[model samples]
Target: MSAKRGIELEPDLLDQRIKTLAELGDLTGDLVATASRLAERLPRLGTAPPAVHLALRLREAAGSSGLAGEVEATEREVREYKQMLSEAKRKYEEHESQAREDLRAAEESAATAGPDATGRPGSPRRSS
Candidate 1:
């Protein structure tokens, strides 16, 4: 992919990217799950020293706006990117198939049509 040549989509590279995105999605999902479990299993800290307890800090680390939330967001983004890439691949394959079919049809048509079929100037005509 270069700026001067326009988008040169390499199928192998696209497939690799899709695979990487899937792997990242899985890793992020795992992280989110672990963080969620940590957040859920921890007991709420007592009110005496709300901001001073170690448990509170641990809970905050796994809080909704912390590690768990960030990982969840990453997982979602990866899933979305993978889906879009898959759709693009599907469309490209479909278009390639259609183009091949069209080319075959054109060749067949030309083979079946004799030279005089064009009726153009200087084209050989049927001999009576």
Candidate 2:
């Protein structure tokens, strides 16, 4: 099932998204640490076969291609996405700077060239 959601999508929002991704990465890092310690954190279940089997299963669930692994993978993906977004932001800033420069140059050029048929820079031509 899907529900419609309203969100503002703008260039300025990239920074917020990047920060959110970083925060998500941090959370996943914490999860990985906790999951890695799951075996040690688990209580002593005694020497019975059933207990041993349960302990082993729990350990596998915590470590083997499980919570820890999934968290680590998610962290890596988040970091990668953050890097990509940072690169895109840098490129966008560069292009924006260039565009501003270009606009300033055009304005300066226009100011120098002036208006009307006369060569005067700021003065307008008077009717005869």
Candidate 1, residues 1-128, lDDT tens digits: the string is 68889666778888999999999899989999999988776665665676447677788888778888988988999999999998999899898899999999977786689776655689888788
lDDT tens digits, residues 36-78, model 2?
Answer: 8884555569899899888888888888488888888988999
What ranges in model 1 sit over 4 Å off?
Answer: 1-7, 41-58, 116-128
TM-score of each: 0.72, 0.70
- In Å, residue 103's CA in model 1 sits off its true spot by 1.3
Instruction: Tell me how far the alpha carbon of residue 65 in candidate 1 is from the true structure, in angstroms, after superposition.
Output: 3.2
What are the Cα lDDT values of the candidates?
Answer: 0.84, 0.81
Task: Look at candidate 2 and give me any clashing residue pairs.
Answer: none
